[model samples]
Target chain A: GELARAQPVSTPEVEAFLDTLKWDKNGLVVAIAQNVDTGAILMQGFANRDAISATIASRRATFFSRSRSQLWTKGETSHNFIHVQDISIDCDRDSIVYLGQPDGPTCHTGAETCYYTSVPMDEPKLLASTLYALEELIARRKTEEIAPGAKPSWTRRLQQDPKLLCSKIREEASELCQTVEASEGMERTVSEMADLLYHSMVLLSVQNVKLEEVTTELRKRFGQSGIEEKSKRPPKPTAG
Target chain B: GELARAQPVSTPEVEAFLDTLKWDKNGLVVAIAQNVDTGAILMQGFANRDAISATIASRRATFFSRSRSQLWTKGETSHNFIHVQDISIDCDRDSIVYLGQPDGPTCHTGAETCYYTSVPMDEPKLLASTLYALEELIARRKTEEIAPGAKPSWTRRLQQDPKLLCSKIREEASELCQTVEASEGMERTVSEMADLLYHSMVLLSVQNVKLEEVTTELRKRFGQSGIEEKSKRPPKPTAG
Candidate 1:
């Protein structure tokens, strides 16, 4: 999920950016391509300055194919084009990363990413934690203003009206409770809870509160007396 | 994201189910563990009758360790237990699948799933296609009478009150439109649209409309003139 900050740079700026990279003897740099929206590692390839230039110029991810011994414009044959969003380089400058939005699957095998194959849990933390993936996106959007054009995300907009967010949470929670208490609609309960989870994440995002904090509190109560744990909490203040 | 239907199975049933499995000469069967909630494959291991018995008895996934030459209760060392929900045998009965909810990461290497490494184009059809997953789940819930105990899904309940669902959709759509028109909040528009998407999915589910059908219609209009496409569709009935 790690990538570089992207900003539009001109021809000379692009050239200057490339000059900063420490290329290998093959005149290629290991490139990691990550999905722009989902924050998933879509694929990885190698790139030379020429390929980078073509990629920047064409706004498609272009790579120098080591096997083919030439510039390979991705999607040239597959048409699964990776529209380049930003290009970033590692601190060492030996490796480069391309952040892009793919029109289709990135893996030639039809997978979303090149590294879709689990490699003995080489990087377990990076596994697509599907349900909360959107939550993280919203969190990032709230914090980093990652989306270009100064676009405000839904998380940002909801932060403007905490009352609206809270009301939605309460409504969704009540609905979820009703569904569950009725026990006559498991799927509905799940669906209702999903809505609640989304709204709850929005609240957490707005408050800049991490999920792990709640998880930590939960963990603390794992073997302790619930009443004892609750006894230590700060007293609830009257509503302002 | 394939898994078994996880309903709390019983002892004799578990025994009968295990009996149906065709074990290897070493009395082993490959057991694949899957997350019941997200439908993500968690891990795979071998299990013998004892392991299965222990798993069923303890309500935790237990596996046979070939190298260790003994029964290995998952999360024994790591505390990342897979709380067994259901066990299903393959059609061939040579393999057993354990659908469970993990207390933590499933893979010893710290991954959510052992098969997290995706193989190249191994399964091309499932490269996300995100929007309709909920629709399919809702559809399944609506038709199959899933989640034993004869639960009428919230989708079903909402369908009974079509006007309520319609109003929710209309409210969400209007809010989404207002957010976009106001242009002061991009995130609000996204959140609003999310609400609309959820409501729309509910409508589709109740009507038993598959997302692919809608997609097919959209695809048909890809290159056609919008005005022409609109004209070709059946005329709308007059509003009541």
Candidate 2:
């Protein structure tokens, strides 16, 4: 929990006006972009009056192009459009966050998100995007009709036949289990689990099944009883 | 436009980890919820293992309920949930920004956002929501075939007949022009113009037309040659 201990800046009327006032000359504010569906930090930029106005007016994120001294709407050239659901300023009024949906990979590079540098913790956008992509891939699999041992789009293949995909999901899950059983810390355990879950999502997507469906069914069978839900799923087949 | 003069904290990998080591008492991080849609400071809360994991797993914003000391997923109860898209961390490595789509009002009080009070600026989400609601009402008029004069709802009546809505828009524009013609300073003129524009948006939304559509059309018709775009719009229908 956070406490906004800092007193509200005095001079309420002026502060209010300042809050509403658009940037003059060089005034700017930090703007961070995050995925609304997956909970990932995509990128960060700066906003001036022109950029902020454009962003709000378009319901898409925009930023002042410091390099060109002009407005730069993200994905303007790439078409990796981000649709803004909302925007908020921080307590100090120095920064903002744009929460919205992403149309494609946020980073110019092929990565799912912008921040690639390992900053100890994965930047939120990357994680969200990766998960979102996996979800998309999984959903796609459900609609795809393919044959066993046939090379379709990886996702299509996963969906055309469940056996192989299940095998992978089980393999990844076992790996995840190994990490936890070995007493690996949160970082390793989380990383392994993420891989397992992602594969599982991919498997589900290929089948055209929704995670929500599984959740609803689970809830129905268990009725808020996690222990009971776990007890009901068929046991995993032994390693081949 | 924003420049954070705060120097990037650089440290040896080991040193950085050691220096910023938060004891794993609960094994969680602090999450701050700001209204990305409205620029409001909603609330502050924490994420424990279950909270963070559930948020990531579900792709919905979840925070640890400090009072209950358990994982609390926002929107779980209200259905006005924040579907997380991206996340980020401050340089200090202590706090995070969760960006996502808010299902409805973020605050419990039915405000457009969580950080409603004390925020002075005209938040985008508030304006957007108002505009969105107005647009829906307008669309309903066209779709449901309501009668303008006989309709009970003011917005519905205006939308049922385009001519009436157009007349209101013209009246507001005329009033705005009169104010501008009489006003002296920049601030007063700008203020009057904003009101005019806002009313104009309401009128436009009522027609099942978005301001973006007009702007986009203007850009398309007059984007390459600005002069031509201006020449085509019928000179504001000659205020009469």
For each candidate in turn, the TM-score is 0.33, 0.33
What would the DockQ be for model 1? 0.03
Tell me candidate 2's fraction of native contacts, as a decimal between 0 and 1.
0.03
Runs with alpha carbons beyond 4 Å of true place in candidate 2: A1-25, A120-205, A208-240, B1-240
Over B148-199, each residue of candidate 1 has an lDDT whose tens digit, in order, gives: 6654545555555655665565455445445533553644544544555555
**Tens-digit lDDT string for candidate 2 (B85-189):** 555554435455565556777766776553333323334232222223233434454456535554344444444544544444444333333332343344433
Q: How big an interface RMSD has model 2?
A: 26.8
lDDT of 2 at B21: 29
Worst 10 residues of 2 chain B by lDDT: B1-10
Question: Alpha-carbon error at B115 in model 1, in Å?
Answer: 28
Can you tell me the CAPRI class of model 1?
Answer: incorrect
Docking class of predicted structure 2: incorrect
Ten-residue region with minimum lDDT total, candidate 2 chain A: A1-10
